[model samples]
Target: MNPRHTALALAVVLLVAAVAPATAAAPVDEDAVGDLTVTTAPATASAAAAAEAATASDATDSLVAESDVAVFRLNASGVPAEADDDGTLLGDELTLTLRQTASSVGVNETAKTLDASADTEGVAVRTTESAVYVAVDIATTAFQQANGTGTADAGDSFTATATVTDAVTDGENVTRTANFGVVEPSVNFVGGVDEATAGGTVEFTAATLLAPGTSLTIALAPGEGESRTTTATVGTDGRATGELSVDGFDAGEEYTVRATAEGTDLNATVTGTIQAAATETPASTPTATETAEPTGTSTSGPGFGVVAALLALLGAAAVAGRRA
Candidate 1:
């Protein structure tokens, strides 16, 4: 071979080695290299799209939680106070109470009544209690209006009424009357009853308690050999008056008085006794305590020693927490 041609081929071989490695390493765009393939978007834009999808999912969950809570409240309002039971009848006040509570800690519904169960939703319920009181006015004049009642006689029929309603704001009354009925009492009087013989008037009395105009049957029982009965109405204290001849009684006979009353709104019976006056016992009353007992240094019961030890230990914790 000729020396010049051999030298030239050697130079071309070295040049090809260097240029081939450089061209292979160079970056190539797929979209530029192919007519149909496309290059992808930037990494930052793809990440933002993924984050937006997650945010939308969280927003849907938040909207479902705020709409489905149940609630209720007390029906009654302010009212005036009244007295307790006494001989005289009066209007009484009524009170209504309310308790609002959740059926479960979470996944339950809120409502007025607890009997109806709540559904299992991812929800929390809150509860509260409130109360209201209303005033009512009851009078004897109300009784006259209920029954077409004029003058009442023995064994007559009548009716009484009862009602429940809201408290009155103005001078007017508002009541939801539930019921009213009339009734009579049962009372009987017998034995020695001196009408005008003694320093004071002596009258036989029998009694019962209940609503007025209510029917009543009385059964009387006089002591030992005395038995007498009468038909009459009982007063508010459940008392009916009758008279028996005291003049003709044997010198030392036992006597008794009894009465019974029956009515729709009232029913009760009462009795009294007639006896010879006897010696009375002196009355004794309880004395008031002047000195109160000391409460210090008490050391009794099973847990007293344990409580003392606990109190001693608690002082250190309190001091440490306060200082810190």
Candidate 2:
């Protein structure tokens, strides 16, 4: 009764332990209900000027030149409804955190929550939690001194991370991240060519981040000689053009063409060869053909004999009438 009953009792206990819930760790079954993306576009006139004033203290005419004022758009979508089950909607209380890094370029770390009840203007949040779109018009300093390279390098970037917290189910949270870069001051040659006529003109366009009347310098430098320089004012479309006559430049000579924004470190250069003026051939003139006169015997000699015979006959008839 002692050994047999003890073995039976031990077997029963071991069987129960095997079937009991194991506390081993398992993967979390969390659904990603929101996706975030960021895009950039040029800012408006008023907004751009405001950004320029905030970044620099120069006079209106002497303000720093930038490619353009930048505006960031943050789009959050695929958000599940509040009444959806956990299988589809794993989180709630979605928050967006935008953090800017490097050079006085991007916006500071800004955080905002998503709520259907708050229909704030400028922040277009959907009533059904399906989409959330917002534009960041915060003025950013376009200070070019940070890169020291006079360009918007990798250091100027805006990183945004959207986090969805599972406040309802107390489950895991998910995140989405996106990045945008600041535009650098640049002058792009419009319809640029590798060769230019000795006396022809060259065309180019500059970025109009600055005022419309901003001045830009265009120069053409030969391998050895003084540089031909000209200035052009920036247009509303950010295009500054000037025609430099290469009259003194010889054909087949290589020269460097450069465009620089006044009062800014932004500049661009390109090489071109001086081409000779195209020569035109004169058209041929038609010649007049002369025809030779026809050679034939003169009829005047035979007509004179006929006239003399008629005259003699009339003279004889007159004499006979007079005698009668």
Candidate 3:
């Protein structure tokens, strides 16, 4: 071979060797490259109840509700190679579904098809790169039915299955099952004053459908001040009344009053205002005597004593003349 041709071949071999490492570093397995996971936190009502229960030092009540039932967190390793060059996960290719496994536990089907192009507030998606994280809040009607106003227990147990699929990858879809219990207690704030004077007494009434002898925590959170917490015990009829002093709260400030069962996730809240104390005005006392004209006498003609004296003198003079 020519010397120039041999030199060119040698140069090509060296270039190939230099680039091989980078090509081999790319991830080949889909699971190794990306992952999806879901986790849950206490529902809103459940958390409130738990807070109250903690204050009361009771451990018998447990609760859950529909308003803040389940929170889901989704994390992806990076933009999967299967995603489009713009880093958008195809809606049809990527999907997440949630279903109830236990027949006794009633749950609605929650299926979401992700669209990287669509505007989803909590769902993470990128047009030029992979979305690393997304969060979803799941709402279910089952929780509402379970949170009744009766004394009976809502339900015994709950189980749910979550499945995530990536159609682009040949790897198996990921599935996870979560087990939960519907053990939160239920409480309602039935009656309370909407406003109270500073340093005055404010009373609250709550109804807990739990068994008697259960302890409850009453919390008063002012809009701008520290919170006041108190404890009460359930009566025979599941009714409890608590009192809070409005001493530290500022006048005209708004506050929220919440009642929760001890050791369970059941609670209620009401809004109220701290009113300013009223100023007392003392009654005016009457003066001893008021300056005024006499009621029966005429002021312009007053001289009765002098007139009487003159008449008496005339009468005496007339009598003396008669005698003379």
Tens digits of lDDT, candidate 3, 98-190: 333354443562222222222333232222123222222223221223233111124544443333344443445554444433334577776
lDDT of 2 by residue, 114-215 (tens): 221123222222223234333333233322233231333333455656555554323666566666554455666766545788777655554444445557
Q: What is the TM-score (0 to 1) of candidate 3? A: 0.34
**What lDDT does model 2 reach?**
0.50
Best by lDDT: 2
Residue 275, candidate 2: how far off, in angstroms? 1.0
- Candidate 1 per-residue lDDT over residues 216-237, each given as its tens digit: 4444343455455456543434
Ranking under TM-score, best-scoring first?
2, 3, 1
lDDT against the true structure, per candidate, is: 0.30, 0.50, 0.49
Give the residue spans of candidate 2 off by over 4 A.
1-181, 203-213, 287-324
TM-score of each: 0.22, 0.38, 0.34
